[model samples]
Each structure stands twice: as structure tokens, then as C-alpha cells.
Target: MSTAEPQSAFKVKGQGTIYLVGLGHASTHWVHAMMIFLFPYIKQDFSLTYTEVGFLSMIMHISALACNVGSGPLVDMSGRRIIFLMLSLIGTGAALFLFGIAQSFLFICLLVSMVGAANNLWHAPGIAFLSETFPKNRGYVLAVHATGANLGDAASPFVAGFLLLILTWQETSMAMSIPVFVALSIITFSLLPREKNPHASSNSKGMNLRDYGSGLANILRTPAIRNLTLVIAVRGMAQVGVVLFVPLYLVDVMMFSPEGQGTTMMLMQVGGMVASMIAGTMSDRVGRRPVVFAGVTATTVVIVAITFISNDLLFIAGVSVLGFVLFAVRPVMQGWMMDLTPRELGGSATSVMFGVQALFGASVPILGGIVADTWGLIEVFYMLAAFMLIANVLMFTLRGEDAEARA
Candidate 1:
């Protein structure tokens, strides 16, 4: 019914989608960043080794992998993405509330799993909606969405760390769930123009499992998307590795406290915010691969530099640069995928690619945990750099059409 609103010259136009969906993007990163602040507290509370803490994410991501794959086709097929988005918020928020009261290691793990499941459901649908609403400027729009994620990532650790000084980790988690209420209010009250599932109308009364599988298979048959999936997977894996262990490296290797580490994390995300905007615009001008090359190559250099740096100022600068290039690459990659996918299959493509990414990204912590357990936290960077370079190389193989698509 509200689908007709997209062309009515309404003042809000598609911004409703951007703002609400972007908030979800920010929320996704917010959970990860908040966990960094909680890590020390959780470790202390549960007597967890670093490996045990790493396993929390491992379990969460594994659960997310299933949800991510399913969310895409549903978004592609359903007329109720907003409903799905609202549900994602409710479920994740409820899980966070549970996290606040969690007493045992298993209970915390269970809550994180629920949180992960909810988190994975929003992205494909949200991005698919944005792509349909703002077809011409997807690179810029998704970049704006990525910036929301950047701001959230930047804010969460600093806020959580500051809160930890005044409150227990449980209390800080309770506080963290507050944004869910704000987001839910917006989604519930805002007049978001209902976005059509890009897949258009189907004759079937309901989606069968065969439909989901075949739809997903059809999307992946394209070479560009297949290559893109591989690139994003490695990039995602590298990013998770970096974010998961950077705090550990700062605290264990550089002897920085949680507060100091939070500062570094904030700086990195601030830099990412700037880079995401620029890279999205740059992709619309020069091409996705050029932007990809610029961001990833620089990111690789900064990541490797962080390995040896001991100076506080210099290390923070490196972290900042790493964040910039890493976050900048996301929108370009996402926009590139949009360029390659048919409008109808957009949601499915996004989900399948990101699902693979979630798979690889989720696994990084376990592997990095093993490496850190055996060697040192700093050693994790070596693997991260390698994964990033591999991802960078694959970006060269993206569809020429993606490079040509500019506003």
C-alpha cells in the first residue's frame, strides 16, 4: 500500500528507509564494539581464558550463518521487511537484556547466540530496501548506511568503557539495550514507505525450501557475484580478526588499559566514518575497484604497521588508518554487488554473499584465538594482513559493469 509513496515527492522520500535501516546497521556494529568493553569484565566474572571469550563469538557467528542465509530470500520474497526489521530489534534487545542478568558462561553464550541471530537478519533486508528506494545512488546511500555503522562502532566502546567506571558490566549492558527502544519507536511510528521485495510477485502461495535453495543457487551462478562473495568473505574474516584482537594486543602487548584501548577503537571508527563517505562518492566517480584498491592496499599497510608499533600516538594513528580503509571498502563492495544483481534478486544476492562473509568472519576469532593462545595477540595481525591482500586481489575480478556504474 505504501509502495506508491516512493515517487510522491514526499519530503522524507526514502530518507525514512535510510535513517531507520541505517540505525540497524549501526546497531549491528554497536553490539560488537560493546563486547570489547565487556570482554575484560566477562573474563573476570567467569574466569574465562581468552580462548573461552573467543568461543562466545564463535558460537554466535555459527548461529548467525544460518539466519543470514535465510534472511535474504525472505527479504527478497516478502512484503514485510519492516516487520522483519522490527522483529530483529526486538529479539536482539531481548537477548541483550538477558545478557545483563546472565550468571553462567553457558547462559551468556546462549544470549549472544540469540543476539547474533537477530543481528544477521536485518542487513540484507535493510540493504535490499535501500537499493530499491535509491536505485541511482546506491553507492552513496549504502555508504551513508555504512557511516551509521561507523558512528555506532565508534561510540559503543567509549560509552561502554566510561559506563564500566560507574557501573557493573551487567548494568552497562542494560544501558546498551536502551537504543533498541529508540529504534523500535522509530520503526513503529515512522511512516516508512513500504518497499517492494525486489523479487517482485510470485504465483506461489508460500515459499518452499526448494525455492530458497534454488533462488540462492541461481544468484551465485554469476561469476562476478561468486568472485565478489569470495572477496567479501576474506575481507570480513580479516576485519573480524582485527577488531576481535586489537583490544587484546593493546592491553596485553602494549600494556594499555581498557579505557586507553577504547580511545584507540573510537579513533579508528571516526576515521572509518570519513573514509566510508569518501569511498562511496569516489566509487561513483572513478570505479568500485579503484576505490577498493585504494582502501584495501592502504588498510593492509596500516594493519602490518600496527604489528610492530609500540609508541602510543603512532599506534593510535595506525589504528585510525586501518579503520578508514577497512570501513571504506564495505560500501563500494556492496554497491558493486548491487550493480551486478538483478533488482528482483537483490536481497537474495546480498544475503548469500554476506552469509558466506559471516561464515568466514565468524571463524576468524576461533583461528585467531588459537594463534593468540599459542603465540601472541600481535601474531594475529599477520594472518589478517594476508587475508586482506587476498581479498584485494579478488576485487580486480569484479564485473566491468560495476566499475562503469557511476551516478
Candidate 2:
């Protein structure tokens, strides 16, 4: 009986929980990517400048940074992962629905701030759950989790484009919120295993306020953790710059229609979906540093080359290649951080990782907006390339063994 019970739990842990979490992850990203898809419409409908549109993202990230800091302690202290996860979906859906009806720029800023703060509720708990469940295959499992995000990222733009053809952006947003609140929330509650005893969980026992503070401080003080966190933040700047400006470039400079922009963005995310699987599995075998080095190096080269390309098809292909290498490294970075920190501190570590990411990443959109207003949209890619180079240098300075050795 004992043997059977362990085996049954293992099976569900291996298959069922991961699927539920991945689906929830996808749904969370659907809200995020959809907002990005609406940028062109928002800019036009409101007669907003580049700086104004960028402020929306800046507000989002700043709110996210604040939530991320608090979420870690909440996850660790409460041991209520599902509650946090559910709130993430519900909050995002509600915000998007309200945003669709919002009439003023100030109201829009408030909605995006809500989106940013709510959206981060998913990551700290989600990452801690997955990392704990799939300890042996951290890289591969996190990659699978990331692939769900790629799906949401890939499909939202295309779906948003199609809906925009038929419905107003307002109507489309209201419609998009339906599945998240109705379907994804149901799945999350139905399939994810309940925490029978939060007090009994290993993560919470004997963990007090002073201990969490001292532990978090110790974790942050480590050279490897600090270096990895900086690398993520710097690389995030490149990513934020690209995601914020690329759609605008597609609309304004390239003169692409909504459908064309969607297709290009879809292709980029599809490449990420494929490369995520490959990079995550490879990092498990070869090591995280090599994968990080190769991926960032390729990302820099592609972003630089993209500036010179004028042909529409070639430009799309270049962006696709950029997505392949750029996102492929993300799961590896997560796995590397998990390897460096203790298992019990997973939530705090994930929070610290994302907090710094949000902190540094918040600056990119506004900075890119200034650069675009001053020079041109294309110049933003040059700035992204510089950020990527700095990320590569930071990654190189870190001294570590392969994740397997550390584990």
C-alpha cells in the first residue's frame, strides 16, 4: 500500500500538475501579450505620443516590481500557491475587461498598473511549485512551462488581429477576458492538487520573519546569485526594448497592417517555442553557461543584422531568429538560479529574480520611447544590442559548474 501510494503521487506530479500549471501560465500570458497587441490601437485612438504609450509599460513593470517583492514572502509564509495563482488569472481578466471600457488616459494607466501587479502573482508561486515538483529535471520542466508562455505569446497577437478585424479593440478585450475567467480558472481549481495542510509543508515550518530576512540577505550576497540576477535584468532590458518598440516599428515604419504585424510576432514566438525545448534539454546535459553564452551571442548578432534589413520577409525572418535565441535562454537562467539557491527558499529566490528583472526592466520602455522620439524606431534595436552585449559580459564573469554538478 505504501509503495502504491508513492507511485501514484509521482505519476500525477509528473504529468497532471505540470499540465495544469502550464495552462494557467499560458492564460496569464494571454492577458499580457494581448495588451501589447493593443498598443498600436491605443496610440492611435488616444493620439498618444511614443513616450505616453511607453509609460503604460513602465507603470506595469513598476507595479510588478512591488508585487514581486511581497509575493515571495506571501508564498513562503502562507503556502497557498493555488490561491495566488487563481488571483493572478482573475485579476488580470478583470483588469482587461475594465480596460476595454476605460475612457481616460489616467484610467488606462490605472488598469495597466493593476495588470502589472496582478500578473506577477503567478510567477513566484508557480516557479516555486514547479521547481520543487520536478527537482531532477528543473531545466526541462521549466522549459515546458515556458513553452506554454510561448504559445500564449504566439497566439494572442494573431487572435487579437483577427478579432480586431471584426470587433473594436474594446469589444475584443472584453471577449478575450471571457475564457480566462471562465475556462482557465476552472481548470486551475479542478486539477491542481489542494494543499491539505499548509502548516505541515516543509517550506513553512520554522520559517519566521527574521529568518526569511536573513536568509534572503545571505542569498543575495552570494556572488553567483548576484551575477545571475544582474545578467537576467540586463538581458531583460533588451527583451523589453524589443517587445515594446517592435510592434510600433511594424505599424509605423514598415507600414504593416494589423494582420501582418500579428503574423510577424507569431513567427517570432513559434521560434521561441521550438528553441525553448531544445535549449532547456541541452542545458541539462551540457551546462547552463554554454547555453546562455550561445543564445545571447546569437541574439546580439541577429538584432544587429535586423537593423540593416529592409525587405519585409527578411525582416520577419530575422525577428524569428532573434526570438529563437533570446527566449531559449530564459528557462536555463531560471534553472541556474534554482540550482544556486536552496530548495526551501524557492519562492523568495524566484521573487528576487523577477523583482530585479522588473526593477531594471521598467526603465527600458520609457528609455526606448525617448530614443525613438529623438532618433527613430530602428535605433532602439541598436540599444538592445548594447544591452545584450553587457548581459553576455556579465554571464561570462560568473564562475560555476554545470547545474547537475551543483545539484
Best by lDDT: 2
Task: Name the runs in model 2 displaced over 4 angstroms.
Answer: 1-13, 197-206, 402-405
Candidate 2: worst 10 consecutive residues by lDDT? 1-10
C-alpha RMSD of each candidate structure in angstroms = 4.4, 3.9
Question: Distance from true position, residue 293, model 2, in Å?
Answer: 1.0
Question: Candidate 1's residue-wise lDDT over 20-89, tens digit each?
Answer: 6788778766775776657666877788777887888788778788898788777766544677777777
Candidate 1's TM-score reads 0.90
lDDT of 2: 0.83
Candidate 1, which ten residues in sequence have the lowest lDDT sum?
Answer: 1-10
Show the colliding residue pairs in model 1: 198-344
**Candidate 1 wrongly placed segments (more than 4 Å):** 1-13, 191-215, 399-407
TM-score between candidate 2 and the true structure: 0.94
